[model samples]
Target chain A: MPFHPACHSYEPVTIADRLFLDLRRAILEGELPAGKKISEPELASIYGVSRGSLREAISKLENCNLVTRRPNIGARIVNFSIDQLMEIYQIREAMEGMAARLAAKNMTEAELAHLKSLVARHKDSLLHTERPAKTDYSQDADVDFHFCIIQGSKNQRLLTMLCQDLYDLVRFYRMRLSPAFSSTAMQEHELIVQALERRDGEMAELLMRYHVRASRDRAKQRLESMSPEELGSHH
Target chain B: MPFHPACHSYEPVTIADRLFLDLRRAILEGELPAGKKISEPELASIYGVSRGSLREAISKLENCNLVTRRPNIGARIVNFSIDQLMEIYQIREAMEGMAARLAAKNMTEAELAHLKSLVARHKDSLLHTERPAKTDYSQDADVDFHFCIIQGSKNQRLLTMLCQDLYDLVRFYRMRLSPAFSSTAMQEHELIVQALERRDGEMAELLMRYHVRASRDRAKQRLESMSPEELGSHH
Candidate 1:
């Protein structure tokens, strides 16, 4: 099977892989809570696993950038800040922009058609929803849109870097910033799809970069408007 | 101290970290050889460390993209491939392009001066060397030049992604493809430096992307000219 550019698609095969997925979900969903120190023994006992399995799981988490491990200090969940979020967007703007460009040149006609249908479905859903911003579906569909383009790039290294290493962090932030979707963002997605349909790599990259940068600015505005307590509160 | 965008700058503080560093050097220097299956028992005995420490070190290598671990097949050193090298260059073109743009706006005056001096030194070294292409000094200087700009971008996450995650693979390729340097690459560096000096982020990004793309083309040409045996040899 071709690799998909979303962490949710990863199938866990081993004990450590299962545990990593569970802990990853917990962190992204805010169930474990951000910036919390990991207690290896406590977690192992709670999960009815050995320390070795838990350590292995935590190492996987660290690879995903969901957990930070220091030499002397133990692992801590990644803390959120607007600055860090902006930094992430900066990366997305570059990497995803490249992905879009590659996809334009490389995506099969069937893939492009699939992408168009996906965007159309998203638009339909947004139009039908009573409160599109309040629904989690919009957020998920947004992720799917980005994932399709990234996977279409046909660059395995770029796919692994974005999907496995970075998208978990993206989900972590998106969970906190629920209701981040907007009609403007949808419009941007439509434009990107159009560029891809035309097979204009340059235009596709430009649109993707613009879309990511606009999202960053919107996220910054939303984050700035929130009080510290509001921003800190786990959803 | 600021985090430098080079893995060699990392200080190994723990046993596992030390092992990781040692093993990383082994892989990049081709002492371990490319595409070799890692034997935990053998490696642990050779390093005089426990299997657990060796496993930890291997895990670190996986994160650096130097090793690939399959569920049931075990870990193997990443095999060299022209296609994979091209993929990496595409990523670098996007990311390092963004780095140049950010550095133009974010780099301090001192950093700019330091960069200017770095280019001057590299140029001087190139002029004085009898066979500049064969010397490792040029490669190191080339790495340093890119590192300076990536560090100057002042994006901590970008620094980590490039330095910790991607550059090792870059070094792996460079080790096999040494004598890849040319005066053209240096001239490209000079243009990027000038753009940064003028604080022109757009121009800096344009020049940086062009440089990476050109380097990719050059590497492709050199690889094509080599015999399959020559390309596969672990230099």
Candidate 2:
């Protein structure tokens, strides 16, 4: 018989890794609302991790600007002020534009074919779907289309920074898509795809910037309409 | 009697924090160099930290895109290829442009005064100096001037991301600056200051973009001229 592997049955999960993934998912899914306090002991109990491990995880989040930690007070989810929102948009405008331009030049043939399929599926969904399905499918398609462009850019640093900055914002804005806005978004995606197909780098960059700015305006409008109570509760 | 603090008291530094700052400084100061392998046990010994703490720091640095960690193999510093560099500059062009635009609208009286003083001080240095000072005062001035614009924008997220991305690039490129470039940089700073003073957001944005692009070109030229051995040693 083969010798038993040493310590084969004793693999253990690291507390810090567990807490990092748990908190990241909560923020992405909006289970942890913006500006909510995150107590170390509370998180440690929930994740079955020690306080030391939880603190490490929170430090990582703070580094990403997903959470803010004070020396004595503990950590909280970050809430963007209006001015911060604008600044985020400025970075997004530049990054998305570069992604589009690079995608035009460097996207693989298979990636382009996949993007075409996504666009077609989205169009079909719009034509036959009722109320909520249309919005959901449109939002999913928007993310998939942009994801393709970013991957095509093949710039790891750019992709990483953009994902960290815009992940939550994209999720929040996607939930508020009106039919009018959805249709407009589909049209913008078509323009970007067409430019990429033609390998027109400059035009692709221009269209991508315009598309992000337009989406940002819609999000701003929705944010402005919310009551202070609603905003506070979310935080 | 009042209790006195214990003599010869020692506060133990956490392993994670020590590793984090050491790795961050090494990357920023080009000590480790781009594309160099980072061994965990080696770093642990160097910093007198444990493997667990070193891993935690590596995780954070990976999140920052300053290091890339593989599963079985360890981490390595990032080496951005030419295409990646172009993509980085494209993003910078848009962000620096937007920063200048925002700075024009929002720069405080005190900040404007400080910017003017920075320019005047640099001008005096250029007039009086016979050679480039052993220390790069120009780099300090450049950082201060750009930081002024970033702060004026009052966009925390934008400021944070730009600081991480472009600021590091600026520091890396500073090593290659010649006396000729120093004078040229001063002239460009004057143009930017004048544009800001007139409250011409468009011109300010345009000039800022031009300034960043010129810097990128200079850096590229310097990089191209170096032999592989020279590049390895320089980093």
* Candidate number with greatest TM-score: 1
Candidate 1 lDDT, tens digit per residue, A1-235?
1125243446777888889878887888789988889998899999999999888889988888999888777999998677888999999999999999999999999999999999999899878877755545888788889989998999988888998777788788877764768999999999999999899999999999999999999989988887887666532
True contacts kept of 2: 0.46
Candidate 2, A1-235: lDDT as tens digits: 1001220112224556556667866875568877789977787888887887887778767755778765456788876665566667777887788788888998998999899898888877777766544425466567678878887877665666666556555554333334334677788888999999998989999999899999888767877777765554442
DockQ of each: 0.80, 0.35
lDDT of 1 by residue, B1-235 (tens): 1125243446778888899888888988889889999988899999999999888888888888899898767899999688989999999999999999999999999999999999999899878877755445788888889999998999988888998778878888888874757999999999999999899999999999999999999999998888888766542
On the 0 to 100 scale, the lDDT of residue B68 in model 1 is: 84
Clashing pairs in 1: none
The residue-level lDDT of candidate 2 at B222 comes to 70
Query: Fnat of candidate 1, please?
Result: 0.80
Each prediction's TM-score against the native? 0.95, 0.81
- Top candidate (DockQ): 1
User: What tier of docking accuracy does candidate 1 attain?
Assistant: high
**Fraction of the reference Cα-Cα interface contacts (below 8 Å) that each candidate reproduces:** 0.80, 0.46
